[model samples]
Target: MSMINNAHPGSSLVLLNLIDRVLLRKNKLVSRTELLEVLRPELLPKLSPKKKKDDEVDEVDDSDGTAMRRFEWNLDFWLKEGLWLQDDAGMISVSSGATQRNLPERVLELIIDNAKSQTDQEILDEKNTEPFFRAMTCLLVQQSYTFMGGETVLPGKNGSAQKAVNRWLPGERSLNLSNELPTFLQYGDFLGFLEPFGSGYIVDPTRAIEPYLKVVFASESKLSLNIFIERLAEKLPLLDGGRFRRLLEPMMEELGWSPREVHQVSPSLSHALVRLESAFRLRLDQASDDNSSMQLQLPEGKHRFVSEVVYLSEVNA
Candidate 1:
């Protein structure tokens, strides 16, 4: 198994118990409100005291009460760990494969394994590192690329990895999973897989991630854009140009980083279609030298760029 940065094994234990309680009540889906009520006594007592660190600023709403905020934070933990799924209905449920193994026994084992240092109370150190793992998974498995026994080049700064992870786990939006590149890089070195190279990191396939990818993706062929978009839309329902702007708005605000916004017009159906055509054209430019007809036609609108060539934005690409 890969080394999971689950420093809060105590919280995992609490969640396992919570899952059992919900299941015993013949409920598969538990709302945060209902779960928080039950979790107050069972799990809240185990949470470490909120450290008054000068650098750490709590973004949680003060009126939500400590217990409520903690419950939400714990839910964030489960979401990041990929143990639970929060749906559009604002309900939480066990993920499909989370219970494949004997969870009760597994939870017990985790408790036993980490029991020696459970009370050390060093903030557990990995409360937010889950994004790195999730992002790394997406980078490798979201598209198909064989590990040719060399360094794979990932673009952008270390912080960009968190953006990829946030996109990977779309529903849990309460916690900001940015500024996690350094922690991820440090952890990668400990795992003996990734190393610093230039502005990015050099990923060695044989070290760790490759073995995990080989088993997970299992496909040798690259995933086409159509399939990639479809699969991405499953997790991120708004994975289109229309809804994508709405999603990017909050992320940009939280990250304190802005991408140049060029809204030629409101992202209507016409704009979406135009964006789609541009995407395909951009892909064609990168793809193999096949002179196949793309069959792209301009939509019936004043926004049509039939006579004039429409340029694609590499920034958004």
Candidate 2:
């Protein structure tokens, strides 16, 4: 689905070439000539579609200028996607807010809000991966296998998770378990979002992470805390809010709040909820500062906490 030429330089190639060129110059604005040199393979037509002898068709023929037009169109697409920015002088560079890890290599890891709005052609163009899937992976990773001195584990087997994934996906196209699943798993593992657990894989849930957290936090749309918690509970019924505390502790720790030193589960749960409230507040503050249109506001309340016993909507209200 090349929005530009549709034939030559498919969307994937155009995107990869653009990223390669941008990253090569350290994400700086490269000149048109520089981009042309980098994207020559895709830009140049491999063969003439058809030799046109008719004078009228030849006069209006944009064959010779196809490369330039394709480049311009693709650049505009990226700009609209907020992946790139272009100056009035015609220089192009990565957008200021695209600082979620070394973008060129991990470009696909980006999680955008309202990802479902993307056309089917656009999804296929971007390697057939879903943005919501990426957000779910981030949430999975945020969960921990152990808390304090006790072992905490996700409920059900890999089969159960796979079935849930199939049911959760919005579209009609079924996931290719053989080819696509492995690729998705490998990519998440390569990005350090997953790790080997006993016989299967689990999310890493590391503390010294911010870029990944930003990606997780960027899911402020349908994948908000209330929805996420509900989904997790549905998929893994054994994982109650108390178990979720273990999953959320690292984020709490990152926000300068210490996990309760007590080994009791109730106190730890309270501490985790307190930290989660702080994290939500901080995210809201950041959103306000950026003038983001994200509707992640908490309802009017004296106390706001993330707990399974209390529904998020009720607490916010």
Candidate 3:
């Protein structure tokens, strides 16, 4: 089943964080029932009905059932996608690969890995693309069209973003893009890839990439702008020149998609780097010649060229 159809809005990350916390406290894999028990109190309040008046009697609440279903959907999706694992006895724990990294990093890594593993056909399949591939498609569409003065207003009930997404998909598939688009937006916001702007969101991965600075830079204190982009693309393949972008290139071209620009840095990425530099997380240095300098797109249609990037310090979360 599609995550859009079965999963609750913003529940994936919430469930993952809760699972991690419970596992940490228990110090071992938790049985399904035990995990549910721990999650019940945390989830019910949000799902339960609120009384409008103090004198009103509480009706029979099915919130427990609702909470359980949501939890199961999130758990199943994560397990099937390898973000979470289940043992022979059905004991649940976060995947070994997901440990050690911060929560956002873990989720981001899992999303990229899962999306990359899927074939183009699988990604194009409406039934198979929910949550991960669909979310990625939405983000790309947001960057390509919405951020560039397109008609898609995110977080709007008008469904402009949904229409934009449907246009990117193969014409043969007649999937009704509705709730899933909004859900993807929520996930993007929570993961720090999309920042809320006015009534919508601006394509900004600054917060998303912040936690991974150490991992991205590794032992190197400085890197050429091109090298930094390469390293970042390796970790987050949804960026410019990333594997996902390359994979979608042929299909996108077949569907009459054109490159937004010939520049090495995308507008969204340039925006993120500029923000990072302003936050004192990194330093961007310009060279005398434009040969190796990457063009960075700034606010108000301004542009800055930088040839090298030096990691200063990690921004405290």
Candidate 4:
């Protein structure tokens, strides 16, 4: 059996860490150091002034009527902002709900066009780019039923100095990674997802979001997506980004199935679906009493992304 299914489009905050700028070498672990560099600037003391003098007796001091104070500062405020790093190694890692590779925690979200092609025109279209970028973006904070309206609380610099580090990521800042964002996709790691979604359905969000990030810190590869399930699972939750998710309906028609059919029936949805001629040489194949050879596994219809896995030839037809 092909055993393919539409993926869920859940919401995710892909926090591209400004590890190079914000975080020092010590603070990079998600469990130990999330949001520290941005939200908790206090954790890292602001760079002090360097006083200089011509001679030892003429040394000039810029201290505020006192000597500079230094102490082991509390770093909880930085933890509120989501960070991406592997276990305890202290390197910036992309936060992941599933088993995914880690990237710098500096990205917010994504925007892209989904047109598949073998030429530059394909870059203009979102079809061939979805899987390319989807596989690149990672989850900084895992979406959970337990946490709805995300909130971050952290300890203060002092025992009684509690501070709520307001880290409201800008909608644009979170989606597009500044123009000229680099291409960060590792094809080997991202190809499996596109394997199922097909290269035609892939998209390169890097170009779409290139203009939205800080140009100085943007990536060259740009964010792109592929056909991985765990990554595709983040589609629905991103509805707030606007008209991106509505584009998934075509998959239903391509599968020789209708939204009404999937919505109306519950148990027989798999067998009830008509396979595309190109997908399976035979429209329907009997696998066993438990599972069918040709069946459509629809993602939960409550989100904002296309969650159907229809045959590609069906789409061309």
Candidate maximizing lDDT: 3
lDDT per residue as tens, model 1, 93-210: 7644345234533332232233234332221222333333333433332211112223333433433444544554455431232223333444443443345666555443223321
lDDT of each: 0.38, 0.38, 0.64, 0.24
lDDT agreement of model 4 with the native: 0.24
Candidates 1 and 2 compared by TM-score, better number: 2
lDDT tens readout by residue for model 4, 15-73: 12233233344334443335443444344333232323421112234244211121111
lDDT of 2 by residue, 1-317 (tens): 22212332323333545554554566788665666676564544332233243211121334576655656555555555555566777676765545434553334324233244665445433432343243233234222322321222222333433442333332443333432343344444444444555644554423113233333334343343444434444322212242223434444456444443232122222233344445442222222233312222121312233212222232342
Instruction: Report the Cα RMSD per candidate.
Output: 17.1, 16.4, 5.4, 21.2
TM-score of each: 0.27, 0.36, 0.78, 0.20
lDDT of 3 by residue, 1-317 (tens): 55543234334555656666667667678898987777775444344323344222232455457656656666776777666678898987765544544666666777667666667666656454344454454455334533544333454446455555555554544334443555566667776777777767777788877777788789998888998888888877667777666666556667766665555477678878888888989899987875888787655566788999999965431
Clash count for each candidate, listed in order shown: 0, 0, 0, 65
Stretches > 4 Å off in candidate 2 = 1-21, 24-27, 42-79, 88-90, 96-101, 104-110, 113-131, 134-164, 167-174, 178-183, 190-192, 196-201, 205-209, 212-317
Which residue window of length 10 is worst by lDDT in model 1? Answer: 141-150
The Cα error of candidate 2 at residue 204, in Å, is: 2.7
* C-alpha-based local distance difference test score of model 1: 0.38
State the displacement of the C-alpha of residue 145, model 3, in Å, after optimal TM-score superposition. 6.3
Candidate 3, run of 10 with poorest lDDT: 48-57
